[model samples]
Target chain A: MIDPIDLQLIVAIQEGLPIVARPYKIIAGQLDLEEQEIIERLSRLKQQGLIKRLGVIVKHRRLGYQSNAMVVFDMPDKLVKQKGEQISQLAFINLCYLRPRRGELWPYNLFCMIHGKSRELVLQQLTQLIDSCALNDYPYDILFSTRCFKQRGAIYSIDK
Target chain B: MLSILHKQLLNNFQQEFPLSPRPFQDIANILGVSEDEVLSAYRELDKLQFISRIGPVIQPNYIGLSTLIAMQVPGEQLSAVASIVNHFPEVNHNYEREHLFNLWFVLIADDEHHLQTVITGIEGKTGIKTMQLPLLEDYFINLGFQLDLEDNHQSESVCT
Candidate 1:
């Protein structure tokens, strides 16, 4: 668990970093902490694997990646780790994970996201992924997103 | 249309962004452009909604608990159900996908208890059962996207 001050720092920057000459310094002013402290804490947090990345957050759809599909596969439990690692290394696949199967309601255990400029392009990439990964035997589903109701960064409550 | 500098900035700086007092300046030095040029380009990118923000993408389940949830809602009641789910700050990403369990969303909370409470509250409000798919393993190392700017087409609005 992180300390209170570190948690406060996460809360401050979770939304975004100010786009300025000295963004960290600006955050330092807000938290009444030294600029170096903010930088050091962020570095440590990043090294500790709490922070995945620190950079530009591109809106893929705006960049013409309109075709987004969540492709899920029902793989043998033993092969999940190996298959997940192989599928994730592909350049087209953005995110991959292993999730629990909800019995008959949901049987998919492996999931990955692919975004492309068109549906045709996405499907073609999916075909390539299947061929390359030798995943013909697994039952999979492609759930293309129809609409986005809401999208934003996660907000963690500091009160807790 | 994106300028060369704009494309470079978008493609190259997706991750490992300069963490310093004058990060824009640092980026400027690397790109062989003036600091003002880099700053203005980023501002333009933000205004155009090409980039969401400059911030740390926290690793999942690090600072708080989160899970992927899927709910099967009646076709007509989809909007209403989504609105109810969106009311909670814990629900960050909510989407309508092409599947029986159509509404897929992500919920993040300060702890496991809070996470369960939000899930129950959503079910209570919408009167629909939600299948929680918590992450069992993350196979992908999220090295931010290497955007292909040249292939990008003008995006048509997908949001209702």
Candidate 2:
């Protein structure tokens, strides 16, 4: 289990690691710990699956991926796992996961995000995904993002 | 247009950030630059909002509970409704989608009770029913897109 110090460190760097020559050294100074200690603790957090990956977050829209669509699929529970693997491997699909279906209201059990240069291209890729995965019978809807309201890293605090 | 350093940084550092005492130094060595140059480039990229952060992208539903909630808001009240949802810190990502369930957001909380409470609070404040869809499975998690800088720049120049 992560102790208080490690939890605090995780919270501290959730926004980002310092963009300095010696980022750990800077973080270590601020946290009143040794730079090596900070690195070891971070490695531990990552090993424990608390920290997923240490990487850079790219702005996809600025990179020319203009079209973004959240596609929801109503697939059988037995087939979801089998088909989800196939669907997620498609080049256009970036995010694919199984989400619980809301009865009588929303019946989509599978969700995937496809991004492309245009809506038509995204739709074409979706068609390709559907045909290749043999998911023609499943009912689905494409919800294209119209506007981004809020996008920020999830901040974790000690208190609820 | 992506500069030589920008292209190299974006392509190389998106995944394998060195787990060392001085990661920027390692990058500097790879790209044949001074560590200070690497640091400034990172700062510039961040300042320009080309990258949101350089840190761990924690996996969802690991330490806490998270749900995708959608709301149907009238066109006139979108701003008001969005502001109400955005007021909560738990709502990390909020977006307007082209569907009857137009407004969608992801809420993360410490636990199930906390998650439910936030959803309830949103319902009370916005007077809109939220369709809760929590993840049941993950097929693909982080599929980072590598930008084709050449094509992207060429297209932008043509458009402009």
Q: Model 2: per-residue lDDT, tens digit, B2-118?
A: 688987887678766777899999999988999988888888877766777888877777667788899989999998999999999999779889998999989999999999999
- Compute the TM-score of each model's chain A versus the native chain A and list the values: 0.96, 0.90
TM-score of each: 0.97, 0.92
Worst 10 residues of 1 chain B by lDDT: B151-160
Q: Score the docking of each candidate (DockQ).
A: 0.78, 0.55
Positional deviation of residue A132's Cα in model 2 after best superposition, in angstroms:
2.6
The prediction achieving the highest lDDT against the true structure is 1
Best by TM-score, which number?
A: 1
TM-score of the second chain, each candidate in turn, equals 0.95, 0.90
Quote model 2's TM-score. Answer: 0.92
lDDT of residue A29 for candidate 1: 98
Residue lDDT tens for model 1, A5-87: 98899999988888888999999999999999999999898888888888898888889888889999999999999999999
* After superposition, candidate 1 runs with Cα above 4 Å error: B156-160
